[model samples]
Target chain A: MRCFRFWPALAVISLAACTTAFPQAPNYGNLGRTPSKEEIQAWNQAIGPQGKELPPGSGTAKQGQEIFANKCAACHGPAGEGSQLAPRLVGGRGALNIPTPSRTLANYWPFATTIWDYINRAMPPKQEGSLSASDIYALTAFILYRNDIIPEGQVIDATSLPKVKMPNRDGFIPQRLEDIHDLRARGCGAGHCP
Target chain B: MSSKRSLRRQFLKNGAALAGFAAGAISSPAGKLFAADAPSADLHAYGQRSHFENDVRIGSLAMWPIVPGARRDYGFRSPLQDSMGIITPAPLHFIISHGHEPPDIDPREHRLMIHGMVDRPLIFTLDEIKRLPAVSRLHFLECHGNSAAAGPTGEPRKALAATVQDTHGLTSCSVWTGVPLALLLGQVGVQKGANWIVAEGSETGKHSKSIPLEKALDDCLVVYGQNGEALRPEQGYPLRLLVPGWQGINNVKWLRRIYVVDQPYMAMMESTKYPSARLDGKSRWFESEMGPKSVITRPSGGQQLGARGFYEITGLAWSGGGAVRRVEVSADGGRTWKDAQLQQPIAPKAHTRFGLAWTWNGEEAVLESRCTDDQGHVQPTLAGLNKFWGIDADYYRLPPATADMGNFNAIQPWRVSRDGSVSNALL
Candidate 1:
């Protein structure tokens, strides 16, 4: 059996010698070929409807400060004042029902993931979606700080960002399942969602 | 241009002489009077107002005003401050759209086609539509996103940049004369499998909505005439769908087609963009009915209070669900509530005006009004709403489920100061 294997190896070596383009395909135009499974898997990372596609590489809040100042501060303002150009990102933690002159994400924005997904898909304006995985991690950390979730020197990354609790995260209730029966039972009228 | 200029000069010159003659004739008395010579409907032509109004007016000629900007995605706001009474005048109502220019539809060439799951898929001409059994009602049609503003919080609440009219002004009520959708469905004979009817507009990409067939047969209408005249161009001239108590989008404008199906069409209006409240962590969709809401038109923001004398706090309250039974006013914040007087004969799905007498103490206090519809649904407080529906959700249609269900009916308090500045107390 060993002798037969050696013979096959020898045959393959000879076959390679017969081709003119030894490490390259001679038919380059046919290069519209499917990539190998491994190659496809490497770039298929995406966070999705089920929260399964998160990529690797975590960062911290301290690192996030650097990322925010460098990439986000210009448009959102140094203190997140928000401009006609872009919306303010933080501050105003409890202005929901007070006679204050200001409000920000700290008082409103319902979901933490909304922040993450928004930044991931649309932030770093000049080069949206161009932030590296680590850059996103760091930026998330910085914003959480500005929102006053985590203090200075706190490091945010995949692990900590998801765990960091948010106010008003549970503000909305799921839509009630209603049909003709429900509508009639409820005496469907204006203001009532039937 | 030259002819117009000459006509104006001639009219001015003759008008002066005519005025002199009329003045002399009236002085002489009897049959000499020019009262009978006043302009009549024959001389004035159609579309002219019988009486002049001091209030700001727009789009009077076409029945609908053309918004200043041509971009279909944008529209003009209604002049809420300038308007009087509960019913927003047809011309001053805010007009919003989604990428559809005004269509030049000919009623003679138009046909409202009812198809899909039906015993008889029939196409009715504009005349045939008018001839069908008709029912008229005075109701209000409002946009779900009408009050898009920057909330007292940092997040945008009523986002509209225009006046309260722009934000809350896209509402109107008129005697709509047309065939009841129920009668039409009876005529067409909707099949048992038909549960949803998708209303289509003439504008491309803007046509489509899935409405429950039962609801359609109940209160929907194929409206033609508005305010005793044919529908205006901006108001879906020729024809439009009126789903009573439903969101404005459900009432498709420039309606061109109707498709009945067992399942919802899953159109863009239903799948995405409409606001839904989140409850217990799930998103709601296709919420058509607007909640009971009220706006204190008088003493509203930007209005000047000349003095601290007793003044009437007057405003309009309406519910897409039903008639507004009562509206409560809180002059000292939400601490105490007193019922405001509701105007007589409150009709269902109509704008009912409410008034209350208040004596300003010339102190910084909160003034708020909360409406309770016939359905017994009370208005939620801003703080209570913020607990579940973050002020920054960007979507007002459906709020999310949160630990803050306890805050559902928090009183929406408005702060008023001696300086006459009125703002949300929940700043």
Candidate 2:
């Protein structure tokens, strides 16, 4: 088989079949169908630390203060100090080493892109995915600013979000094959699954 | 034959069931009914457990930092003290909500989309997935945070004054039925260099996890059946991922998407919430796989042992590494130990029942059980586990600083008080 980088779109299954499919199980050929691009877009919303999947549009904390107060303050509290119902989003900046470090975004999250991706996909609780891209960017900037990670005027978008390094970027133990319990001797090693 | 008798008189309805018992400490199952008083013979088409069996899971949103409005930040535990055998009743299986509730979706309409870093991105209807070759195997699903006690490192899981049900009930096993995920990936022809796959669910929060492709290709499954029937709504209903022996979060319920990628996605659950913080402040990520552990269920906490002369000590033992090789029970704390008989079929990655006849002298004796898996890893003492996490075996009692703990497989000790009552002895 030839090696090539393939960008996938849904419903593209009718391109015949992959001869290499079904090596372990019986050749129960053609059981599933190629899905439409819309179906793919509906569920495959993953954005890694690189923020490569981040979309267009941008906003600053100046624009976010209003959005957060209107949409988030009820559960997260004013200025994201956290409330009885929800956890804190900002502040907890130099506390990762404490016995019980307050895992606010400032001290725990390893990537700024994760914050953007999380808000974009699941924010405002029950009314998730309802916010505009600009609204999400503003909210992210507002959180970063509150944690003193970025200035209130810093514009956040696909480009700037990836560059905003996280405070606890190196807080996590690096992934190692032998380190993954019960996975030793399995095909996984050195961050690759062979 | 009893119709001629007076309807007012009661009869031993379960005489045959009672006949199976030889009658040492056994009494008729506390149920008495006359033939005439029997209810209309609906036969309970769905089949209900005997009214005498009222075991229920513990769902408490009141478990610290109560998030009231959404009610989504909650989970339920199985009644382990009341559990029997290997299979956890489908209805009583433990649940971890993780900020999302089970969604309602028709099996016909629900589709599992498999895309990204593949030669053929495929979508399978529930029927289509079911149409493939299927295998049924028993496996246990345990949360990483199961069985943690309040210890010196921090206020982790629970207070010492909790029942075995409350302490170790977050785990349950089932005979899951479905096609292997390798079969599905085999059909998709996974692209070279793809090492991880992000499994997403249909919940409102889209409950998701990034799993190693090695695991998916090994024994992971797209199961739609549990025990002997279709999956329960709470157990992912029409479809779920079964990552055998791994921590429960990776077994995404109501599975919807499988996006193969080159590296970890580091989603919110994986990045910020699930990592276990070490004593040194650095945390471990993706440290799945529950280690070898066992706990005595009977004569456990909350239950009173009336006349504990010939009480049998029994509980469950399991390991993510392999089958339970052996289980040793200790009557006088860890000072002495004796091998317990392991009930069959002693399968890997599933609950193995172990028990032994004990003529309790009925003093204030402490009881504990430790298991060694087929991989030869012995279950660690609470102190040994603490030491493994960098240091300490005694209860130095520092206020628990963090919430997320990695794999809490420490041995649990139960104290049998002189009053014939059992309680948690971890303190």
Candidate 3:
């Protein structure tokens, strides 16, 4: 008899727990409207080392020279000699390995992909990643030729691009990580030698 | 209208930050962390600025400054020399961070855990770790990439005095007080086969690293105090692992967990990014330890002097592998060198301040410094250093093996003009 009496109460408690008090929704004062498709598309683009975000269309080194002369010559100087505004991209091969390494691309940079990636990310300073896929290829080819890495007449395309190797491809050294195990085995502390 | 409102908000925020700095000055046990002799008003104004200061608070163990605002740009560096005795004061020590602001951690809630290849898993609260027997010693920590630009054949030889604090200034030595990692590893019972130990931080980026397990069982320390005082928020408050003779990056900050493993943690900061220079014309996977170098500080760059007379050329010298036994300063370029006076109680792996007095002939002259650590290793020049490492491996600056190359100890030359103007001119 006592169990039967508590059962109904338990059922009523469970039912009560299930119900939630719903208040009238508060009004949210609207601020800015949703962005348009064009706005969204403009911000979504990014170019990876493998020409991931490259746009359609093709261009040749001949066209790229016109673009380079009109746009890049001011800062980079003719033939990428580099003015005060920009860094010299040519020369510097085997320079980083010399005592007191200068750390330029020719001397220290390990990957050719870095050139493509950097150009896609931060070239022109003002207009970033605006070049079409063909333009990028042409620019890369032109720069490589100017750096004396590639033949001036060599044609650069998707299939032939990845094959190019940088002089500093093997430039990096492994991190020492300073195991400090030997130091400890020898009994070293802050001040007193172990 | 929006600009006006924002200006008002800025005022309120500044007011609040000022109050916080003032409260810290008064309530903290160390008292005014900088310029205590001056009135509170002047000190408050000085605190509001964004420049690094030279004055250090008296009685603080480590020579650190109470940085007023959060990280605005790159963090500040502590002065290595001009300090006597060991134990860098907490306020005056060096500061380095990548982001806009340094993380602030609450010690009461903080805990460090050891996991992975350990026989037994363990977690120790900050309080529990503090209860263990502590050891304090003065030591220096240098960023691996320190002096990356100031190598052989350049103007701004005095870049050492000015730039040292910027690049190498990431280093500091203080009487760190903490429970040894060996004790902690002993408690957890490190697994037999485990060779590498990876330490992870709780900061914004979750920066992590893999150190040799032997190091964890050796002299690595989980420190809570610097220079006999509680660690500052900027200097990895609550707990920071001190790995002597290693690059600053390997010494994990805001330490949270230690995982024992068979292989090293090839985190981005280590394998791909930091490592530069390959042997088969390929990358050297790992290179560590900052080599010997010296920089003059008192007559550093970007300072307006009252009048040029007899000024002492003084600066700090240090190494990672061992103690700095000797330091030489050259005022007439590297053609000749004079021994600079080394401060006493020079502990191994700590900054040794050296000074030399010179009377300027009121003409232009070059200034540079060199150091020899406890180990037989000597600083090298850029030209010599490049021959061994290769031009590609220019990212990190390791300790020099000889005075011949590697650019570790390229003779720094600071040119002083007749008008008392000091500039880095490669003469």
Candidate 4:
């Protein structure tokens, strides 16, 4: 008699719970709004190594020489040898295997387009993101020329920058995070080891 | 303790932080209880630490103030030797900047743009973000370049002056309150094949990094609150991406953009700066996880252990993979080991305090701690880590083996002399 009295309430509760098993997709506050075109243009400036977003304009190392001397030399040094104020952009080839490795663009960086991208986003320290498309292309060209990877007369823009490969383009290998898991599961040399 | 530390401690004893506010109270004629004004008048308005307490963080030491060609490459170091527990005080928290001052952003105007590879590209204001469901969790943020075992240009084994702060101060844990990135991504609907997201900051340089979308959706946060208060300006103030377990740089400060993409952008920070070069002549890119690491703080470098008959050996252990499951303390280098008791609230991806009972006999000894994470990954010794990289055993002198590369998590050993003076064993 006591169990029968509560069965009606229990049956109603169980049927209500069944309806919420899968759950309708949450329609939060609908808080985010569509971004305007100007907003997208202002922030979406990250240029990948593929040079998909390189702006129009071309420059040569000859043209880069004058621009680099005036805008970049005070801190980067006149010949791009780097200074107390900045890291070196030239020299230091074949040094990665040594004990005291001096890593620089010539020996370490894997992409030529990276030079242009970095210059566009963060160069000249306090005056970052202030360089023009042509000026950034020229600076990238000048750095490549200084590293002896490019001729002074070579033009660098969206088209040519992607083709001018870095000296150590293949130096970096993609790290597989699962390797740590695999190494722990197996012995020291299970997957790949010393 | 060194004479310099003793002098600093003596100065801090006389109400250093509360100097100007309660000058008359401290300088009273006798041990009287009366003072210049009410205690509430001095502080209590908002909040402040007691005027008497004055443990401070080290701003710059022997090897730091590293100015890398006009970038703001320095930060304050937390005093781990004097640290009491897991949560670093918001004010005393370590602060680092790669470029430009933390922007003086108005929270009302600041916006986070979520574009690329998203079915519904969207922009959310700070107010809008706060209205979404909020969650809080504890995690530790550590710099990849936080070790202090760099040897001299030629002589690598020369002993030097260092403290717990000098060696392992770049890490701090906190209760961060924010929105899970997964919740926001769910709202926007991540498109298929979208595997990476480039996080960009709003500093003058717009410092940025590309994080794996899987990690982003799993545990990442867009945090605005730290340790029960609004985030400090130096700690990305209005907003920051809290990429737990990964190195500090991946937790981009002043976060303003999240650009979803199919391929890694190979940004300079990733391709040029943070990648680790191995012995096989190839560098490792996207090396995200910090290895399990531990360090003894109380009896560590720059501190004197006077008349040590019985002293508790306590330290911190953490991992990027998961919770620290076990920590072993060795008093005679790595020869012998003993398990330390884990403290309560052993939150994953955060600092876990471990204590072991030790009775020191007035003798020379080297102390070290090795941590094992839940994933069965044990911390490596300096020799072992270098051996894995195919480098020489005397690893300190080789910049390529130590400082030049990042992700340094070797066991730190402190040598306690017969006189109870402690210093760095590896240096």
Best by DockQ: 4
The DockQ scores of all candidates, in the order shown, are: 0.06, 0.31, 0.05, 0.34
lDDT by residue (B1-427, candidate 3, tens digit) is 1233323333432342233223111111111234323334555544432232323211111111222222122234554423444445667676554331346788888878776666656667787787777898777876554444433211212232233333344556787889788877766667788777778776654556767776667678999888767888867887998887676777788887777766654553554345533334444433445667667654544222234467777777777767889988887767799999998778777878888988777676677778888776666654545454454333334332111111134444556556554444322
Cα lDDT listed for each candidate:
0.57, 0.75, 0.56, 0.74
User: What TM-score, computed on C-alpha atoms, does each candidate reach?
Assistant: 0.58, 0.85, 0.57, 0.84
Stretches of candidate 3 off by over 4 Å are: A1-194, B1-75, B79-88, B150-167, B278-281, B303-309, B389-409, B425-427
Q: Evaluate candidate 3 and give its CAPRI docking class based on DockQ.
A: incorrect
Interface RMSD of 1: 16.6
Q: Give the CAPRI class of candidate 4.
A: acceptable
Docking class of 1: incorrect
Two-way DockQ contest, 2 vs 3, winner: 2
For model 1 chain B, where is the 10-residue window of minimal lDDT? Answer: B23-32
**TM-score of the second chain for every model:** 0.77, 0.87, 0.74, 0.85
Off by over 4 Å in 2: A1-25, A175-194, B1-42, B61-74, B151-160, B391-396
Q: Which is the winner by lDDT between candidate 3 and candidate 4? A: 4
Task: Assess candidate 1 and give its TM-score to the true structure.
Answer: 0.58
List, residue by residue over A1-194, the lDDT tens digit for candidate 2: 21112425422562344334423445776889987778777666788766767778899998999999999998888979887777788775666665556677778888887777788777777888899989999999999999989987889999899899888877776644233433454442211111
Instruction: Tell me what TM-score chain A of model 1 achieves.
Output: 0.60
